[model samples]
Target: MNAKKGNTKLVLLTVAILVLGSVFWVYASFSLLGPKDLGVEYTHEDYVNALEKTGIQIEYEGMTGEELEEYKLNAEKKSIHDYNFEFSDYEQKQFTLTAAESTALLNEIAPGFWWFDDLQVKVLPDGTMEGSSTADIKRLKEDLYSDVADDVPLPLPDSLNIYSKGRVSVVNNQLSGDPENFYLGAVQLPDKYLEEESVNTMEDYFPRIYTVVPGLEITSLTSNSNGEFVFDGVIPQKVSVTKK
Candidate 1:
């Protein structure tokens, strides 16, 4: 009886330790990342620096609604692949980013462009990218237009969800790059496409991300059980540029 009680105590203690560790992990990541200031908070210094580096120094004093959306998209186009701002791989090696870290990085990269109700992006084993996002239709419409009609919020669907599954790979930039330097290439798209005009628009409008670094090659892209995208070959330097 005493042994059983002791075992129970040990199990309880282990669980407690795990719970505390999980909490700390989340806390540390967020704290270390801080508020990367996107969307309405564009005036922040880090934001301004990123904009300046990319030649998008514009005022946001009185902008809102559609105007704000345009500014964000334009900024992303210019800065999505800029150094320090977007691609910060000093070591030219492929690395895996956690869901939280990647989310934070992307939010910083694109800022207020996505007025999403919910969203997620994950690279599974075999280089398959599984992505999902949702938006409140009414809210989106309102955000898109400076003036909204219908006094009572126009009745509409509660939310719209968009999903995408696709294979990804890297290839040497045919236009520019040797075997050593490469660009991220899409080897395949999922058999199941979202088929939503809005989703396609979202994918198209976002700036295309590509890399340009010497002596970086990616033979294969896969992930561990933890879903961390792994690179088979030497992880190239992440100095991506907005080619388009």
Candidate 2:
């Protein structure tokens, strides 16, 4: 190659490397900015407010890293809740829940207003639960708005029976505990309702609840001992970010 050509190629190569490096650096820097740099910063209060809006007092049950550290320095006794690690680790938040809290949370995410005739939760020894709810599909959908009821693919039957129950594990966000186990309620229907299209549409339409929380993935559900629906999945990330 000619001397001038070789020189031109070398300059172009250097510029290309610099451009790529600059682009990569910008991306890396932005990734390191944490939640605060994204514009509006959300405190714990915002999370509480959101929960309150749902008509449930889902309490915040974990201490922040700074509070935890300070408590360790001042306390005379250290229990499970106050244990301090020798090395730094990500702080996990675990919110304890009652049956009412769990029911409210589930209803909040359920499409339309699915009122349960009898909603109950039996807290297990390991913080998991056995939940059962008796829902009268016909009664619940009676007052449903035209637009809201239209979204559901199947027509609202004037009279229908549905019994739903499940065993599940509820966990807190950012915590080292088990991921949330949302067992879809086991569905029971009359034999007459077992026709092909009815079965297909009813099965698909009834169990169609999806979690909208960011960074949460729900796995395929399997039947438990009682042939109830159960899925293993991570709890929703509680950290809320806003763009200012």
Candidate 3:
């Protein structure tokens, strides 16, 4: 009887270990996999079209050595406020940006800005913006844990799937919105994790459209089932980027 009891206990322990291992494997697979494709793709042509629609110009020529250093130094000194937004010369105009165009524009303006790989954005029919990207864990660690002691071991995944949904609008001439949902891999972050300060920082990530074009206001920012965003606002004759 004693021998029979020992054999049964060992079998149960093995089964439990197998179950736990399977669970961990499932969790890790979901966390490491990226979000589903949105079925939209953008090309370099789309980026150029988006820039043209916005009336913005990027004047960058291949500069080598000293020329490149000078350009970087000058860019650092100038701010959005310094840009010439001659409102008086231009009238309000309406324009729309397709989901592809929007995504292309962002990639061009700031590639790897959020340390995301293959970042994409979709404007839902309900006017909410959804974004997905593969987070670069190394870059994230360097940015977030710069002050932490190097000796301390931080156990983090090599990469994570990130997704967020939010409604954004211009309030008092500033970007404003709180994300409705945020997911880090397969885990949905709780409301407590989305602090007010973090929301503010997210809002600040985008440039103030009004500041970019003086007297320009977003009259209506809505989306369609096809994932296109309509922008009813004034557009400048031309937006120039110069070192001055």
Candidate 4:
């Protein structure tokens, strides 16, 4: 009787371990365990096309190695006040950006900042936007801890797969939207966590269009079934980004 009981217990323990392992595997597979493939591919041409639409120019020709790095570092230090905005042939126009273009633009704007990697955005047929990225949790915790109270508990993993889905709107030249779903790895965050004013909108993610294009007025901004973003706006002219 004792021998039979021992065998049964061993079998049960093995089964439990197998079940737990399977569950964790499933969670890791779907969660942000690594970078997600957004299905949109971009090339150098795509990047150039998207950059041109932003009206910013980068001059790094004839410079390589430390020289190029120094130039970019200096540019990073510049504020809006430092740029010279020259306007000509001011007018309102409609612009569109495809998913590939949008992805390229975003990556260019914030490449590897905050330990964010493989960032991508997708627009579904229903105009729902989904964004995903892999983040280094340790770096994020350090950054957050510096600003928050000492007693604030931040139980976080070493890294996380962050995802968000939402609809976006542009009104009065301001881009704003509340994410319907937000996730850390495979776990969906509670609504209360997403309700915080800071994370609720896209305004913090983009610069004021008017600042880049003086006298700019965005009448409408929307996405289409083809996963393209359309913008109707009036601007003094297309502003260019040039190295000074």
Candidate 5:
């Protein structure tokens, strides 16, 4: 090759390396920034409000992370429901529940105005849970376990990382706890479906229930740039209401 051509190629290579390095730095820095941007700003009051708004109270049963396994199995067996769950190492906490207890708890804790479709309610022994309607499962899974195609030029960190958004399944009954970190609940408007008012009620109600669930926290709630509301957060344990 000519000297001039070789020089041109070397300059291009240096530019490419700098560009790639800059991109990586930006992604790493901002990967955890989504929660802050969404305005979740969790506090003690937000937690208290969550339960009151839902007309429910979180009565602690004093369970721990180790106890959660039994409660999980009991819920599966009693409900005649098959489920697969995963949790993050950091997220484990105590909870107490049975299948019947779980269902009752779910009914009690959830807001009356909001109807979850494929409700896969997983309550740990420590009182933590992953509850959502069936309608939201597919998107939930994809968000939790992010995917990317090989060909994309501008690399983007999985926008749906555990810290970014919580998985929601409006249809199926699979709950995962893989990224089980604590966060307070902060419900915001749904981005895409704002025209539909029902979602608005949910946005307004989630924080109220957070109050009584001491072991629980609603970390963050957000919507897409397009305005689709995505709720993501954590509970310390499951809260159940039994037949007196």
Candidate 6:
């Protein structure tokens, strides 16, 4: 009876230790990663910086409904515009122009300018300017191509008897790298056939990974006894995989 009781006590102690450790770990995790998860709030300065780096112009002053819409498109990084803003001086001046009108004027005024390619520009609601033009387009292109040139090999699908599969892991995303780089992935089949495939002839199928944990460097995967494939990776912050 004493031995049984001692064993029970030992098990209970072990369980208690584990529970306490889990609780402490949860608390520590919240303390460390909570701030990162909270999200980064971009300030006006950040908005300006991001826009200018992309070679957009700033027009912070009053604008017509059309001009404002264009600005919204640029500012939101969205092609769709669903709102309007009227210009205060539109009626008083002959230069009453919408965003589209202003763009036309600029285009006529600055045709073949190609200023956008290298400029870091922004336009605020009231027409404030904040941007730098240090973006090196040539260097940027070289870096992008170099990264994509490095490839990953995928085992061909078994049944089709496909010999080999090759792919390029996404090194940069729209939010970080050149937008053109990501856009290249969207080339249509017609356009693809028109242009020569530089890397691999296999139809460039986008890789669809099961997991999307940011900063996770996946190295391997395997199926467990439960019939679920477990992915293994080195997370930027080491996270332990424990059985429940």
Q: Which candidate number maximizes lDDT? A: 4
Report, for every candidate in turn, its global Cα lDDT versus the true structure.
0.41, 0.37, 0.62, 0.63, 0.34, 0.29
lDDT against true structure, model 2: 0.37
Q: Choose 3 or 5, whichever is better by lDDT.
A: 3
Tens-place lDDT digits, model 2, residues 1-244: 6999999999999999999988765444322211111122233444344355333221113443355334434433112213221212212223333344444445332212334423444344443435444444444444333335656654533332232222333232221112232222222344444445544454443333332233444443333343223434544333322112
Model 5: weakest 10-residue lDDT segment is: 76-85
- Measured against the true structure, the TM-scores of the candidates, in listed sequence, are 0.31, 0.29, 0.54, 0.60, 0.27, 0.18
lDDT (tens digit, per residue) of candidate 1 on 123-233 = 555545555445444544544432442532434343444444555334332211111111111112232323345334434432122222344454554556685555444
Total clashing pairs for each candidate: 3, 1, 2, 3, 60, 15
Q: In candidate 4, what are the lDDT values of residues 72-146, reduced to their tens digit?
A: 443432333434445555666677788888777665542323245567877988889888877665554453334
Residues 101-129, model 3: lDDT tens digits: 98887655433224556678888877788
Better of 5 and 6 by TM-score: 5
- Best-to-worst ranking by lDDT: 4, 3, 1, 2, 5, 6
lDDT tens per residue, model 5, 1-244: 6999999999999999999988765554333333333222333343334433333323213432335323433331111012222212224222233333333344333322122222334433343434432222233224321343343343444332222133332211122222233222223323443333534443444333233334344344322333223334454333443322
lDDT per residue (tens digit) for residues 41-115 in model 6? 234344433333223332233442356446544442111112221212111111122222222333222112212
Location of the lowest summed lDDT over 10 successive residues in candidate 2: 31-40
Pairs in clash, predicted candidate 3: 92-234, 93-234
In model 3, what is the error at residue 29, expressed in angstroms? 6.2
User: By lDDT, is 3 or 6 better?
Assistant: 3
